[model samples]
Target: MRIDPALRALRSNPDSQRIAQTALETCKSGWRSAEGNASIFAELIRYGRGDELGECPALSSLFADLDRAAALVEDLVSQILPQIAAHPLGQVPFRHQYSGGMAVLQLAAAGDAALSLVMYERSGDTPHSPTICFTDTERHEIALAGSGTMQIVRRNRGRRAPAELSVSSVEMKSGQNLSLCGMFETKRIESVEERLVILRLGRTGAAPEPSLEFRVADGELVHQASGDKRDSCHELMVSLLGRMGRCDAAPVLAEMTRSGSDHLRWQALRECLALDTATGFTALCGIARNPADTLSANAGSLRAQLIEAYPELAAFEKTLCLA
Candidate 1:
């Protein structure tokens, strides 16, 4: 097979490669300059704190000021686009691609909060996905260009037993803004006309509840994932200890079972029972007997299941009666 002339030329472009490398170094230097727009925004968020802003209100206030936000985005765009053009081979530091035909580029971050640029290209061949997932975070977004419709779904705060939800749709256009509290509400781009660009500020902190995904048709929960990194780490440690057969860690696991998030408590209790049956059974019984505890019903059901699977565990119930 004969080699294509265009391909052969591309393979031997040392002069172009050298020029591209010089352009990339220049772009990097400008981006990291002390007096650059990125540095100003970074310092603004880190004013009263260390490298990270400890309070969410600071970021919230910045995002709420529409005029200031617009100016910041304009300044960032003026710097970012030229950098991209100069160095096409370079990639943004933080870029996240969404399953719904969107991309987010994080421009600056301080602690749990971050400023990001969101972009979606209009595509008729590969349409955007309808599925939506909600995280336990606070978000504020300002549209810089294009137009779309945003669909907001909120769980009714008044209802407890069965999850009740309400839906609302708002027209999104250039210069418009929206704030969403993901603790109870979620937003999705219902439709986009042409291309859409947005400036978004997000703050994700420790939340008591997990992030949730729901089926749009039936409004039923499809999946849930933990939002707390610390709790997840603890659960992982407890499981490791159990798998290692570290009987000495039983006391620590037992203590964890008495408090903390419902998910973590149950996980610790399970590991504790596996490592030290006596301590695990006692904690399980305590939780099951407490009507006020949130996991009482679950603990009771778990105890019954255990006894049915391992009849030897029935002896522990008799011991509980004697005690």
Candidate 2:
């Protein structure tokens, strides 16, 4: 019979050790869940002091869940980003594209294990907390991409939506104490007990995500949703893929610079520079002679920058190279 030091401290603490187990259950349900995440997270952070939840070996299971979830998100991005960018609509518009919460993937056949999302409000009978997990696994690999808004809930079955995410991290502290996000944005009674409820969140420079995401099961489009948002998402992916130096993205960038959407020609040209300088230069030459001042000026400006770096482009001084 043996007990870990961290677990021992949690149990002996006057507050309560059950709080740790509760938080573990919360993680089990899924961090994506809407269940009073903002408040529960705060509690976990406050009570996780010492070995209670921080160093307690008993709570290892919960930590494992967190790690696995993170890996899932990372893998999804790495595998599906290229696929999304390769969509036909992905190459035209640059800064603008549709994001209809769609997903394109490579499937084995059908019914392979897959990941999807369900956004249900706190209606009666529905689970009060948001939940996310693998629905099926009949395929070889799984991946996904997109954005979705996660509600920050105050009450378990809160009808009003205004929940924010936060955390505390002793392992990754910046200066003196654990960092947090979207916390203390409300007026609530202050108590050491209440503060102990939050999770120890750390700082991140991540940007905002979309309001909906689609899973890429196989090498095909699954789920049924596509509109401006999805198209926009695709276009953004195309531009991003070009920047990633994906040679496969060259054709798309070149095409965009040639006959794509008029408003996005500049973006296509920019991507082409990275993917195919020849095509990009040709596009610039065409724009350089156009009547539109903005279009011609932009081409001239970009040409100047390129010329400074690539003296070889200076050979085109007689054509499109800026003085």
Candidate 3:
């Protein structure tokens, strides 16, 4: 799996949007289990319209569940919406409409996906609104225009109780391949050792590269080459060198010159400078003059750059310079 592409797409969106999408997906997938339903419901309701409640049977049963779901949805929406709406990327639309004595709220997405949110309200001396929120994930497409409606009624029982009902209707004519709507925030990168483990376990995916890049970025070449527990990193590197070649690990190659192990240092010396005018030339020069190793590859550009900056290599420039 090429995780980098997905990571790139997610980075294009706000971190909060990603997190909220992740939370919403987790809730839908039943990862939170029954105990988490209430919190999920509250989050769905917070930005949702009071009249949109009828779309979900769970929301309608809020009273039976002590309105726990409603409260959770409300809290989540309240906490997340301000940040999501305030994001500078694009605007998310929320519209409120009233018809036949009922109020409806609809949400529209202006960026990648088309979304609708609904709320319902009943009229009387005291009116109540119920809300529900939803995203279209099954079609793997973007919604162009979607709408939601809610209905509310007043009942004259002995107690004069009020009854509320709402329905959210969505029609998506067009769609885009989007990461699950609620999955933006839940993605995480694993450690280098863990990545090696996964690679060894045959989990061939792009998820490991970023982690490996981090190790190189932090100047942890020894850690990258030598696996934490076993010689796995070494074996992996050797295999990758044979198949993908050393240049493929350019970032890592750049750091190998400073590696603790002599073997790694030599490997870096040979491989890091193999490609003409590669980025790792500076490190290659240090290895060439170490006396323990011979400079087989040409290093003219390396010497030129070094002489211009350090001037001390001027005398030995002829031998070190690539032909």
Best by lDDT: 1
Ranking by lDDT: 1, 2, 3
> Against the hidden reference, what TM-scores do the models get?
0.71, 0.27, 0.19
CA lDDT scores, all candidates in order: 0.73, 0.38, 0.36
Which stretches in model 3 have alpha-carbon errors above 4 Å?
1-232, 246-248, 275-277, 290-323
Q: Which one is best on TM-score?
A: 1
**Which portions of model 1 miss their true places by more than 4 Å?**
1-67, 80-91, 95-100, 123-132, 236-251, 308-311, 317-323
Q: Give the TM-score (vs. native) of candidate 2.
A: 0.27
Rank candidates by TM-score, best first. 1, 2, 3
Q: What is the lDDT, from 0 to 100, of the residue 51 in candidate 1?
A: 38
The alpha-carbon lDDT assigned to residue 34 of candidate 3 equals 43
Pick the winner on TM-score between candidates 2 and 3. Answer: 2
Candidate 1 C-alpha lDDT tens digits along 74-160: 765576678667655555435566645688877667666677889876656554344456787777788878888878888866536
CA error at residue 291 for candidate 2, angstroms: 1.9
How many clashes does each candidate structure show, in the order listed? 0, 53, 31
lDDT accuracy of residue 201 in candidate 2: 24
Model 2: per-residue Cα lDDT at residue 238: 70
